[model samples]
Target: MTISTTSTIAADAADAMPPLYGLKVLDFTRVLAGPFCTAMLADAGAEVIKVEPFEGDDYRQMGLQVDGHSANFAFVNRGKRSVRLNLKQAGARDVIARLAGWADVVIENFKPGVADRLGIGYGALSALNPGLVYCSISGFGQSGPWAEQPAYDTVIQALSGLMDVTGDPAGAPTLVGESVADVAAGMFASWGVMAALWQRERTGRGRYLDVAMYDCLLSMMPTLVSRVMAGAPATRQGNRHANSAPFGAFHAADGLFVLAVANNRLFAKLAEVLGQPALASAPEFATNQDRKRQEAALARLIEDWASALPVQEAVRRLTEAGVPAAPVLSVAATVASDNAQARGLVVRQRPASGPAMCHVEQPVRFDAMPRGQTSAAPALGADTLAVLEALGFDAGAVNAMQQQGVI
Candidate 1:
């Protein structure tokens, strides 16, 4: 297998405009899913204005904090200006109206009907700006029987059948290490916004997008979805591919390494590397399905060979022989690896105050679009005064609103 590190592209355009340079986004997302969606737009050069409640986003108080900043909040809320508004306050509606009129896009992740109650729903805002693209992220879709029920990442994972297909077959169903459901919803929400934006360019009218975590997560599991649709039940198979043998982690002398042999040709190569080429032609291991039936025996043979070699050596031998293989690595090791550095996967951003922060950036590469211009996440309501003033609130009105706890 060849790994090409570079691609040819045309030179930058004369304007040097960022992908979403002139876009205006009003972000009402607080936690992972909605915040993550808006954050992607901000990274693509949209001018994102994040509106928060007086108490601020819940994530700011939920995760690891350093220098009075939450890592979780910073990771998802970076590159946006923040404004605080008490939506329950009567005076705040005026500000929301002005913001709605000013924004090209608005995204929220409140439970269904909550945004309507707070006057930030699609019907309310789109009325102010008919060209606005409004997106709602939720656990279940709007208008569903379970739409109003509150859900977190774990709840969505469990409900989506993702948890049911993760972990070891012998063990109980387990949650994924990361918040896959939330991330899936965020990704789909961003895609929906972009698609709506493209459509609005032609129609001269905006669209309302409804994104559900459960739906997005379900769509992400192609293998399990196919199996279940074909009359097979979903079941956990640990770190292995459910339908393939010799395609999971195997123990080495020092640690574990994963291998993939998806077809007879790859299995022949793997068998050759193990000095057991005859196994490839054996009736019990002749085809992928046959090998799967004898998976336990196959694993024993491979593990017996690998158990005497270090993981790196085993991985190197397998890779040299052209069988897909890799040593198991921890998160820290993977982030600090040479590949991550060479690809510029992790980036550092410095806020106006506090120590610099490091995060993994979006992986897409555009030849003409420059990357690595990220700023740190804003402090809660840091731009409140400036934003209100920009929306035509004079000093006196701003002061009175603040005094009355409206902002």
Candidate 2:
């Protein structure tokens, strides 16, 4: 079997879209994980329809509500249409089943059994729509003992040892500033979706995906899990690699920045640049292992040395010396960066009032067509009628369905 990217319409179809133009996605995931996955798909030219319960996504209420919707919600949900549907309500399940039959993909983030209870599980969805790529995002795998437990990003970070690996070594272990688990899970889910889409072209069938936020975070555990597997207990080492020395952030004379000396060669170069070349050969810092053993003394020596030169000067000297170095950038500094502008990393759109919407570009770039943007996130149920009408529902039917709380 082969999955082909052929069009249902004629060649040079004038009313055409970009790649994935004919793909249709039904998004049932809420908050961060599911929404982000669908957003990426939508940005790639998929017709992603986000199905929210009549009460709408919790993200619509939480966080910063702007223009009658959450700013964060708007950021993730731009370029997608909203169709309000209460899956638990009478008449709603059939509508979703219909949507599933028409869709190429179905994304949901309910807990393990929640979808099955609602008759929207992958088993049911795939049965209704054989070609459906059903993606289930959760805290754990479907059959695990911990599958039923609820998990947020903070909990996931803690469970996956990411928390233990963050923060200052002496300070209490802390969660990364952002929701690392949700973001990673969303990215992994998107990866799975694209993989399934590619395979579907060959097999003429789709597969069910199980993405756990906890597992996603664990997959990104850096050296923590591997080291433990190799006989090292996970320990909290703030701002430092658990195994590498002189591979951490240091305070330079004027400011702070990171210096990642991945291997002994870089460490030796770093030492030489700091005018302490002898220390690179000193018994205490002779090798990565020995340097780790004398981490306190090594840090003291490096700090004392770096405290002499200005941060930019130190960075320029090290960079010129072929060392990996970077200045720590605050949010404001990042927003104003020339690199940010030159790379087109941020997209600024004009509005009549208030500040123009400054959006971060989708991280992925294709050598072909660049990304396109729609107006900001929809108002609650903003595209309800238009999307439904496109889906073959009459205006009267949609209004009645909304009144019955089946939307």
Candidate 3:
């Protein structure tokens, strides 16, 4: 749905600056993780300058393209200005140094040593701007035995034990439906940047943040960590939770819906909705532990009752009874749901050319700050001349650098 730009709320929001207004971000990330981090900063009203190679970020050419624009690129790079400069070119180093000096935060996702080689490493930039918060997003981390090894989202998932516990118990390990590793790392990186920024405000010194995809994903899965730490091996349990019974997908007449009966109260509610109130008091199903021990039997009972009803109808009854339940929805369905609409989860931005684009807005709400609106992702180098001129480079100087194949 289109956002109502003329609404009083919209007009008021437009007049108010966001929380990160005036924050300067130099984004040297490509693909998902780094771009995702910077995208959040941009959403908070940071002025993000996305640095790219002459060919632009790899995401521009990596995913589904609509009339030559990469939807994935646009999804993550919204509200950022694009500036193309060849990092390998010596002349580009001068521009990067200036950009780093201008930035309050810098994010890079290159391999650990690549930024150092390019002269945009934390040591170099922080020397120029001691108050700069520098964040490096990587698969393993900035340093470790596996630091130099190349890592993709899938690699991190597998290496981080995420794939090991994601699929059906009887089936082979499976990757998650989306790039959870990249997204987790990006989220942590953004958090790290903000934390560093706050610390800088107190200490009058910036900090270096090393965010690893593996570490972040591992941190996100607290249950898995707790189980392993307790000497219990984490295993795939299909759609069921390892610790809780009646807390996973159940079959309905039309399809699968999920239910969560975490405690005895919820279990009683679920039993009541299932037309089996006595089941909640059964010796084998009384406590959460006892119910988990009979999880398969519990599942059969749930399926038997649910199988007669449609998915949504089953969910509605369970929900109305105070048991957490919901139909399994596709990504598009979730995005377009009434709840999502009410929360303004998806925002529409009209590009200068082509159809309007939809982006998932940053989820947090701040009472004093306005919801952020975004410009479409920039064309490659669209802001280079303007940005350079703003940096005090004359048009002639910028043109000369361009002619030298530096930008």
Q: Can you give the TM-score per candidate against the true fold?
A: 0.95, 0.88, 0.94
Q: Write the per-residue lDDT of candidate 2 for residues 1-407, one digit (tens) a residue.
A: 11121112223544344566678888888999888888777766677777887788888787875565466776677667677777888777767767787889999999888888988898898998888999999988787888988998888988888787678767888889888899898899989998998999999999999999988888987677888999888887777887787777888888987787767788888888878788767776777888888877777876787798888887888888888988888988887899877777766554333334455645766555554454445556656666666557787777788788786
Per-model C-alpha RMSD:
5.6, 4.2, 4.0
Runs of candidate 2 exceeding 4 Å displacement: 1-18, 280-284, 349-358, 372-375
lDDT of each: 0.87, 0.77, 0.86
Model 1 lDDT per residue over 140-210, tens place:
98977888788999999998898888889999999999999899999999999999999999999999999
List, residue by residue over 1-407, the lDDT tens digit for candidate 3. Answer: 11111111222554465777778889999999999999888887778888999988999998888888888888898888888888888888778778877889999999999999988899999999899999999999988899889999999999889899989999999999999999999999999999999999899999999999988998999988899999999999999988889789989999999998889999988888878889988998878899999999999999999888999899899888988889999998999899989888888777767556778867888666656366778889888887887787887888889899998
Write down the TM-score for model 2: 0.88
Off by over 4 Å in 3: 1-15
Indicate whether candidate 1 or candidate 2 has the larger lDDT.
1
